[model samples]
Target: MYDSGKIIAGLIVFVLLVTFPFISNMGKASAKPKPSIDTPVINEMAVKKCVEPKEFMRAEHMQLLNNWRDSVVRNGDRIYVNTAGQSYNMSLQNTCMNCHSNKKKFCDECHNYMAVNPYCWSCHIQPKEQPNEQPKENML
Candidate 1:
């Protein structure tokens, strides 16, 4: 009972400090970015479809890309058969970039929103300014 007043004041200060951030940021969060798929290749497709389904691609694209890299580089497998039984060339540059040429709009949008720094550009050349003369489909 000796330091009851001091203890109460300290507890109140600690609670305020802990809750300050949440209170300040209430209703101020930016909306998540929706990646665009408006490139020429995508637009020209009579039936616009990705290698995998949209739901699967959204959640597991990174894992799939990693698997592709391992398969292509390590195991020397260059083909990917999706869940739908369609075959595709497993490539980030030729296959993916061919369709998703608008890298800033398509790739960077969601990546930046998620605060991730993918090392895709460290070794591979960025295809922003490079023109693909004839954008060919990777799927069979």
Candidate 2:
């Protein structure tokens, strides 16, 4: 109890130092990060769609791509039949990446938001630019 004043002052200083960042950011409006999905390839399409619906694609696109990889690479199956009874070619480069050509605009936007690094491009070859040529639908 001899140096109680000094001990209390030191404790108060430590608490403020620990909580400084939280207190400083309090009541400050944070900028909402708007992820850009609209690109030239996505625009100008008569029918803007994906293999799956927008909600499903947003949540499960990685899983669907993984399934496509397994089907094409492991099982030697080149065709992927979606839930809507539509068959699409199971090639990521030709089918998926063809439409989503701009990796920075489409893929990276969502990936960066969620902080996920999918190892898709590591193995799969990036699609070459086919400007002015709209990505053809997987019609069987």
* TM-score top scorer: 1
Put down candidate 1 lDDT per residue, 86-122, tens digits, no spaces: 9999999999999999887788788777768788877
TM-score of each: 0.77, 0.66
Candidate 2's error at 78, in angstroms? 1.2
Name every residue pair that clashes in candidate 1: none
lDDT of each: 0.86, 0.75
lDDT of 2: 0.75
- lDDT minimum window of 10 residues, candidate 1: 131-140
Per-candidate alpha-carbon RMSD to the true structure: 7.3, 8.2
At residue 80, what lDDT does model 1 achieve?
99
Show pairs that collide, candidate 2: none
Deviation in Å, model 1, residue 30 alpha carbon: 2.0
Q: Which stretches of candidate 1 lie over 4 Å from their true place?
A: 1-13, 23-29, 129-140
